[model samples]
Target: MKLPEINTATPYAGLSPDLVLDAVSHCGLWPDGRLLALNSYENRVWQVGLEETAPVIAKFYRPGRWSDAAIEEEHAFALELAAAELPVVAPLVFDGQTLRQHEGFRYALTPRRGGRAPSLESTTQLEWLGRLIARIHSVGSRQPFVHRGRVDRATLMQAPMQAVLASTLLPASLQANYRSAAQRLDDAVAMRLEAIGPVRQLRLHGDCHPGNVLWTDEGPHFVDLDDARMGPAVQDLWMLAGDERALNALLDGYTQMREFDDTERALIPALRAMRQMHYAGWIAARWHDPAFPAAFPFAAESRWWEQHIADLHELADGL
Candidate 1:
């Protein structure tokens, strides 16, 4: 269950402006300022520009880590959304192979959006967001792991939670809460995963967290479809529920797009817990990976999830 921990900071820790500029030049692109690198759990992204007027981003991925199928899937999803008139960062031309392997590392290029990343700061805007959510969900659900079939919720939760429960390198409080929360929701979790309900799985911008959203003149532009997968309609909703006020605001806009039915509504709290628990567990298992920061946002999310688990349980039992 444990994977090698990576030094999440290694990519940016020693990034000097001169060195980044050098990388820009090496890539045959003019460096307007310096290459801005953003490293996350799975990928490395850098913003480089050929012109001072507007910057284009090129994301260099770790070679062989993401399968060619996944890259293709993401491209398809981005184009799908774009075709619907959604303003997402368009995919620019790339190297013949998306899996750029060199020095045991991989990389790729994708266009950067013109405007800034979207803020979850407004409620009224969320109503607009809800509409987007509805449109996204309505697109057509295709199973992520298996490309040939329609994806249902059961297929999504089954493996991830099993892997999550196996992770151990978590903080004591967070780990404790995870175990406790799992124990409390055992039945509902099992039922949800086992009974297998109707989930309108369409392509999703899998990791639709605030970090992946781009704010533009047109509206919200979804940037990272890396986590794109076939899953539940409100899976994104639970992820956004990390903050209640923002959740409410986004829901207001999202509902205007397509409202959550009563069952989907009731499952929100549990789904929120599911997202945190899954990621928390994943982080714990790899806490010691050389690629990770000894202390990273995963640990922070674990702590938050543990506390929220208790609160959600109290509310659930009361109901």
Candidate 2:
């Protein structure tokens, strides 16, 4: 089922303050009219205050971005990880449903989890995160998502490259340059993946960047499984590893719970290149959304595009 496209410039225009309060109330929660917008561009997330209870997080899924089944699958994966005693924030089930709709919006409520960013410089922290991720993957490997996507050249690079090319955000004068650089990077990534051959693909947190990890005195807990999908285990590992030392630290903890595939290490550069291309393409595709331009003002600058093209070539050359 497709949701009606609202104003392209502000897709969440209809998601007004009143609508959010009412949506939370519909789920049997008493929102105290206090709403704080979270840092999210892909979805409209809010910290809704309650009268007698602590604040709860309300995440309104981006319209038309994912099918109901795909969203439900993500919710299920989060729940599975949480159930396995992993540090994950799963959507709170309301009236036996994790995914709900109020008006035209599909939304979910999760208990608010607060913590600061994980310190990547701390080997102890990285090892703890490694263990957490390994445990999450242990559950992830047990089942495959039937509705979500997979991490691959098509989804991560090619389609996004097409989106960038179609977007008017990239200056027309630099379009040819951007395309050529993107294609070279794409080819390099493809060759690397082909050389790596088939590696074990499994369910992953998908976007395990440091921002998604909340570190506390206890250690770290992961948030945001929105990007969860089938992918190499390395996809989850590479983003968190900044260097060889960090990678070794992560693998040291990872092997405690699950076996690490040495072959997947070779896919890191390819994965990194795909992510770089995907990020630029994402901004281009979402340029119509006011949030994108406001959050990423540099993306509109020609210099940024030129630099991005140069970076793409550099990444390809490195591979």
Candidate 3:
């Protein structure tokens, strides 16, 4: 079967090595040709060694993903966090702008930062991470995003489900079952949000899973704010803790810096449900990209759909 047409093949199909080198030079930096592709699926990122300076990370934003305004808002947010002496990797100000462009691609250059993945198993570590996130949230709440989006059901649940249904990836035999399960999940998520009415929405690190945080001897610092959005503070905290103990530890550290709304804890299950649906939709929408097939081979199998439907039903049952 011919795969569905994707807008562009994985957003980096034409990002050749020389193109990256020229982009660096356009920014007035001399490249040493020692380029290492970083592990990023949403955008193309590379660590390029410089001629007379240390290596720097070049992130080429995926076309059609975020408008230039939204991306600049992200860059400004990072710079704001850094100005507060928070451990965040902000983009370098080249010429006069943090956002730069080259050969039809919008990109930014950040000084290469090195650190190991954080160990979430330690309570102390969790607490430390909690404090940092709280600090981020504190800054995030100070102002609202003019261009970035929010973490809500319309974008998270409805859009993803629509994409999956429109795609050819779902088998004809399983489509009905998947649709029913997903619709039920959508209803449950809506009800959950209604029950937790009027939670405070603030600027958030929208995707705060451990992978986004880099840890060194000094402490933890966030590396990616690409998913930043306006949402409840808990949206940043819930993903850090799987169990009550860990959650409490994270909260323990967070409270030390800023007051957290305990009521937001109730929104965790709802947020998780939305994420589960959003992930499947994201995969379906990107299935036409070559990288999607290689990284998500299971998505092509009937067994995966079976599990996915069942999981959706389980989420509905809980809600």
- Per-residue CA lDDT of model 2 for 205-244, tens digit only, reads 9999999999778878899999999999989988899999
Best by TM-score: 2
For each candidate, the alpha-carbon lDDT, in order, equals: 0.57, 0.91, 0.90
Off by over 4 Å in 2: 1-9
Query: Per-candidate RMSD vs. true structure?
Result: 5.9, 1.4, 3.8
Query: Which of the two candidates, 2 or 3, achieves a greater lDDT against the reference?
Result: 2
lDDT of 1 at 289: 51
**Residue-by-residue lDDT tens digits, candidate 3, 104-202:** 788999998888888878999999988998999989989999899999999899999999999888888999999999999999888888887988888
How many backbone overlaps does candidate 3 show?
A: 0
User: lDDT, candidate 3, residue 96?
Assistant: 81
Best by lDDT: 2
After aligning candidate 3 to the native by TM-score, how far in Å is the CA of 121 from where it should be?
Answer: 1.5
